[model samples]
Structures are given as C-alpha cells and as structure tokens.
Target: MNEPAAPAAPETLEVPVAALRPSLEAVLMVADQPLDSVSLASVVGHPVETVVAALQLLAEEYDEQDRGFELRHVAGGWRYYTREAYAAVVEQLVLEGQQARLTQAALETLAVVAYQQPVSRARVSAVRGVNVDGVMRTLLTRGLVQEAGQDAETGANLYRTTRYFLERIGVSSLDELPELAPYLPEMDDLEDELERVGGLPRTPDAVQDHPAVEPMTDSQETP
Candidate 1:
C-alpha cells in the first residue's frame, strides 16, 4: 500500500506575505516615539528590506488618503506626526496653556543661541543689543537651553539648545534651521557685537530682577 504515500508528507503552514505591510504600519502607528529600521526589523523578525518596503507603502497610503497625520523619518528614525495642515488644530488641543507664547525678546535670544550655540551668555546678550541674562535664565528654567560646557578662553558658561527646542520647532535637529542669507546682515551684526565683548557679562544685582523667570510667557515681570 506504499505506506499511505509516506503519510502524504506533513503540510507546512505558510504566513501571508501581504500582511507584512499592514503589520509594520500598525507598529509605527502605535509607537509613541520614532523607530529605527534595524530596531523595527528586530522586533518584527523581518528583513530590513521588507521593513523598509512596508514603511514606504504605509507612508504612501497616508499621503494618498490625505490623513491628518503621516509617517516621517526624523531624528534618524521613523515616526508618525500630525500633518502641517492640521498643526493649528492639534496645537489648540495638545498645547493649550502648555505652550508659552514666545516674546519678541525671547525669540531674538533663542535665534542667537541656536546659531551660535556653545556660545557664552555674554555673546548672546551682545547679539541681541540687549541684556539676555534674564532671558537666558528663563530659557534654562524652561528646559529649552542648557549649559553645554564652559568656554575655554574665559571660563564662561557655554549654552546650547536642548532637545525640547527641536520638539517645539518640529525639526529633527538644528541643521534644519533656515538659511540665514536673507537675514545675514542683522545676524552678522549680532555676531560682531558678541565677539567684541569677548563674552556677555553677568548682570549687576541692581538690575530689576524677577525671581520667577518664565520662558515664552507674555506676562513676565521685568527684572
């Protein structure tokens, strides 16, 4: 009887290839943060090519659907973020009262720090044509800027933007900052002033100092 045809060689189960793309999209949609390709592949137990292909498909699908959110590569990984068209709506909901509106002075100070990071407080003040001691303190308190290190020449504290700055600006990194060519004259002037001072000086105690330094607040008390 040919031993029942060798038991007909037990059948092996097959996984559906079409399900890969949807599975990857689901994972990305649910993740709270960006996911690296390698990490995603490891978690999904799939080849890198398969994962990449799936991600591209998902991104295209969102684009075609005109969804309010999309998958983007950011911070060296992929993340789902609200589309720019719906930024205002999302901002209204998630950032209500949480985001402080930036003052003109604060914006200027932030621009200086962003471009000339690892710069000294004295430098930032010189660039803004105003004392930034208070503004810098406000930024520090808000977690927008931090002491990157000490300036080797003058032992002054070197400051730089934090990850929060990137998040607030919706950029992956400082490299995304707009080209300054159109506004170079003004920026250059600020840089020159900072260089002249060798560094920004600590404000004298006589300056009207406010104890509660809040960043991006329109109603900050003048020190």
Candidate 2:
C-alpha cells in the first residue's frame, strides 16, 4: 500500500507582512466603529504592541502618501477616517441634504454648556438672556449635551457636554479648552456689577450654609 499517501502534510498557512498590514488596514477601514488595540491584536493573532506598531506604520504610510484618510484614536478606540482637510467635501457627499446646521442661538447655548457644564438650564438662559428651551432640545437631539443628574436641593436636571462634544471640538479633555480671557469682560466690571448688586452675602462664622438654588433643567421652558 503506498504508505496511505503519507498523511498529507498539514498545510502551512503563512501570512506575509505586507499582506498582513493591508489586512489589518482593511479591517479597521471597513469597521463601522472604532476597534480597540486589544481587539485588533486578537483578530490578527498578534501582540498588542505589534498591532499598535502596525497601526502607527500604516498611519505614517498614509501621511507620507498624502492620502485623504488616516488612522485616528477616538472615543476610546482606533479607527480609520478621512482627514479633516477633506471634511467639507466628504460631508457634502455623505450628508447630502440631510445635514442639520446649528443656529447662532444654539451655538451660544452650547458655549454656555461647554464652559459651565453641570449647570442648570436656568443658569444657561440667564447667561444667554434668551429662552434656551428649544436650543437645548436641539443640542440634546444632536448628541452634544446630556443630562448629568438631578441637583440635590431642587431636583432640577443638570446638563453636561457629551463625549460627542469633545470629539467635535477635537479636544481629548475639557482642560484643553482654549482660554476665554479675551472674550470675558474685565474683572473690574465684574466687581462693579457685584457691588451694584449690594455684594454677595457672606457665610456666618459658625454655620456655613449653602444656598438652595433650584436645579436647572435642560428640558424646562423659560417662563
């Protein structure tokens, strides 16, 4: 008997480095969402370091070639996306007629939310000098702000910027917010306003008390 055809040697599967890089790139490119380094490593059957190195190399290659896309770390993971330079073109094509633009009022309300986050709608309205009920709703629907929690005293809803806000602003954290000194009024004007208001009340020496201001709700209409 012909030695049973010598049990066909187990097929050896070899993945080339060049092919592996593109394979990884394709996976990241087509993914509908970001993929963590660990997940990518597992899928590629390689170490996390190897996956990261590959990602960096791919990013560099794209940059060197002036590709319209590159790898980005966003929302706690990595993904391939087009460069911002082509945002207008891509947005026009992808969004088509479905894109919604923010009104000036909405932008102002959003600014208030970004700087004084965890703030109530009342405070935001107070600062903007307009009813923010509709604007806040729009921002919420657009995923820019979210309800953080209710205030203990008034049970009013507190609002804060969402991760979408950070991503849109291209900031990794709130601390990266640009300084607003140039836009703000002078300290003397603020002090003068405080003086005009007969100065803020000072706490008693023994009983340190906090005011029971009503919690601000993003949903409430300015009455």
TM value for model 2: 0.44
Report how far off residue 217 is in candidate 2 (Å). 17
lDDT of candidate 1 over 99-169, digit per residue (tens): 67776777788888898787776666555555677777767756788988886656777899999999999
Residue-level lDDT of model 2, residues 1-223, one tens digit each, is: 5565666888654434475696697788667569998998899888777677777777788899889998888887789888888999977865542256677787888998899788777666655545576778778767889999976876767899999889988999999998878897776664343233323233333112232232344454421
Q: Point to the candidate with the largest TM-score.
A: 2
lDDT of 1 at 178: 96
Question: Each model's TM-score?
Answer: 0.43, 0.44
Compared with the true structure, the alpha-carbon lDDT of candidate 1 equals: 0.70
Maximum-lDDT candidate? 2
Task: Go through the candidates in order and give each one's C-alpha lDDT.
Answer: 0.70, 0.71
